[model samples]
Target: METTHGAEHVHVGRDGWLFLTAGSNNVVGQFSRSRLMARRVRGWRRLVVARVRGCERLGCRYLHVIVPEKLTVYDHKLSAGLRVKVRLSPALRLRRALFWHRSARRACLDLVGAFRAVRDARDLYFRTDSHWSFAGCDTAYRLICAACGAVPKDLSGEPQEWRQMAGDLGSKLTPPQSERWPIRGLQRDAVRVHASPIVELRERTGRADKLHVGAHVIYRNDAAGTDPRRVVLFGDSYAHFAPIMLTALIAETFAEVHFVWSSSLDWGYVERVRPDLVIGQVAERFMFELPDDRFDLKAYAAERFGTELAEAEAKSARKPGKNSDKSPGKKPGKAGTSVAGP
Candidate 1:
């Protein structure tokens, strides 16, 4: 296998595969056995313990999921020139650390093992993009359902179409590479009931990437056979609020599903929603930083985009006899709603 360095951030592997060796999170450097990396792993263990205890106090079941990066799952595709060791991945280190903690051990999901078992079967992640494909998302979804003790919804029969696109990793190259990947249909049984103000503003201005940090949304499924439990998911792009990925899959299976696009858990929001299950999902690279679980979605949006949001609302109010019904700077849905999808 021949591997070439394409861009400063991308590692071009054989057979049209692209791996992200460097990015904002310093993907390859995170594998070091340095003292700092060890401390980071310890912090993750503490965070897991706190999450479990916090959920227990709120009378909800919490499941922590760390979505492995492309390099962790597809290391075999890499060229011998790449010297990073997959075994040194932070995700594995964190999992090993959490294994000793009683409560945290059970809360954390072992996705690395799950992904490795089926890595040779098919392409779990996208060839050009840093995110997972429909197949990869489905594998994680099934594992999530089993952990929650909820019956999984089979979306295999859903209509699918392949579209040409350059994913996040592919776009970083000097000569961008593109691929045709399968796109699944929207959730048949679930409908978006509400979207937060930031979400609306992002859609209006076509600046999803910029305004994605605190996005949130809600989906309701009234199907007869769906699970009765309510689910709150604090995740990044992989389990987005969109109907094409992990959020959509969970929404279709449960009565109500709330998707919060933040790596940090908002304790206040969790208490208010009172969901039966709380899920925290983050990309493996993001494990480099530990969150304090104090993220307030509404306060964050206001502080970050106060002026822009106000201007947008004023513009909408100025339209011919259009009166703004949404509360000033408040999310539009029932209580809590924001958005995320990539």
Candidate 2:
């Protein structure tokens, strides 16, 4: 499940914050020089009283104490029930208000631009949810093509059709929270991936010395030779959606494309299957986290480039040290020879 960082609240803008009042009335105002943002209006006073009464009926022991340090069993149960009752009507109204909000509206416009960048709406995202939907992947492909300044050829003549394949690497790795979310058992749009040298693994009897591997290449028998840039992508599950969408929309633009998720990869896999571009699909949440020993990119980068950085540091260290180590006969400029920069 998604962990809660703190109490939930929505940011309106610089003008002021909109706090949910006792009776579900939105308390909005300009920040005043004084402590309170606003004084209760005439109508709001009655609403507040009604809320207080409701709290009394529900045995709100901590009602008088604003912002309890910790929630108790009674506090949690009562708050949960009250929250449901208070938010049910207000949530819908606020959503409509949010739709008209300039900043919120502008965000949608930017999303539309990203969508247009992909050209094909169908490949933009997953069928069920917003996390890189099938349509989203299509859009990312368009963005990637734009980034590379590559002219995308229309793949209308290519073999592209919707198919109900099993869950891809992406679906398989979805967090448990995703499975437990309110909306369960929704139909997720999936695609059949076609790639040559389809690597499959299995158990074996006897000496099992040989790694059973296979490779195949099918050439189009058509008289017209269609040439497209061959591309290969090595990344996590996130890479699967983008490549699939790209292959669907611009199949002819690339003669062949290969996509592999990180779960079943070795360190040399990227180098072994050289591609025009290597897109590393790591989640931002865990980007700083150290990967497995064999897949430690930070250690690899340090090993490759750390020598130059260390040498530069050592040179800097010498200068400061020489000045700090200066003897009593030396001037302020000669303060270091034995001493180093901290």
Candidate 3:
């Protein structure tokens, strides 16, 4: 089934899965302006590497998952006439940068290729939502686990349900107060995935870049698991769906799971918790937006761990002439530098 709306950003596709057309510009990334250029996209990939390196320093394993635009996966289902007109930007394909770049190959997980490999009667993405359907989420989760060297679970035993829903893109087409776009969920995860309320925070006070400074989420999974490593996941809304099943499996698999929902790249949270595994994810479209999120990890470490690291700096800042190095009664021996008595 193919349908067109006056709003080009929102296009109706087979079986009602709405897609964000090229002009939507609203989808996620600012990449279309860059046309996924190899030189430009490669620069973004390096920014991602810098963040991943911070996790590696903590002895934590990293998996970077990038979600491709929905149309790339199921363009076959798109209406006949508009099909030929739509093409993915080179960056979305990722073949030239992350896929082939040895520098990022280890940490990068190919979500686009992973989604393409599977053939499901139901669409990989949702008809009514901007996110992946439960099935698509399943594929992403399993691939992530596999990439991390963890065995995937048998979800077959889990319970299931179905419901009718409207997707975000479709909702854009509806009249205000209208019933909203309605789509059906044929197969849904039946096991209850109830997350406690999100813990919100604005990181590194007074950051200049608005995109880098914004609300982030923290989700703690109380469920018990034998895996001792605490896990911290960072991403936008895309991170929300990918981890639901991982939490269910992790509700009992890991010691505890924490989520940081933001595009800003900071290692302070990782430093505070010292998680055993760290995973950062983002949509492919937003890959170009990463450079703005960059920060000096060394400064973040000093600023964030100030109280814990030392009292000298804080005490010195408070008093202009005081000898911060000297103990209560100890004398400064050499040019104001405290030293053990000779």
> RMSD, each candidate, Å?
3.6, 24.1, 12.2
lDDT digits (tens) for residues 1-342 of candidate 2? 122232122211111111222212122111112223112222222322333343334332101101100010011222222322222222122223335343322211122334433433243323222234444544455555554445644323323444442222213222311211121111112122332212211111222223211111111111134333444333443443232333343333444444443322233433443434333233211221223414433344356445744564455457744553332121221222111100
Off by over 4 Å in 2: 1-130, 153-228, 241-252, 263-267, 283-342
lDDT of 1 by residue, 1-342 (tens): 222364767888878898988767888889899888899999998888999999999999899999998888888888768867878888888888887786788788888899999998988998998899878888999999898888887887644777888898887775778898777875899878777767767876777666567778888787899898889999988987667789999999998899988999999999988999999999999988887698887788779878887888888887887668854434334343333321
Candidate 3 residue-pair clash tally: 7
* lDDT ranking of the models: 1, 3, 2
Candidate 3 per-residue lDDT over residues 1-342, each given as its tens digit: 233464457666666556776552444234344444555566766765765676778888777777777766766767755552124443354444566556467677777777877835645666766676557766777887777666555553433444445556665665411222223222122222222111111112332122221222233333333444566666666554223433344323454555444555556667766777777767665654444455443454346544533563455446877766643322233232112200
lDDT of each: 0.83, 0.29, 0.52
Order the candidate numbers by TM-score, best to worst.
1, 3, 2
lDDT of 3: 0.52
After the best TM-score superposition of candidate 2, give how far the Cα of residue 45 lies from its true spot, in angstroms. 53
Residue pairs whose backbone atoms clash in candidate 3 = 17-127, 29-285, 128-167, 129-167, 224-252, 225-252, 225-253
> For every model in order, what is the number of clashing pairs?
4, 24, 7
TM-score of 2: 0.31
Per-candidate TM-score against the hidden true structure: 0.91, 0.31, 0.64
Candidate no. 3 TM-score: 0.64
Which candidate comes out best when scored by TM-score? 1
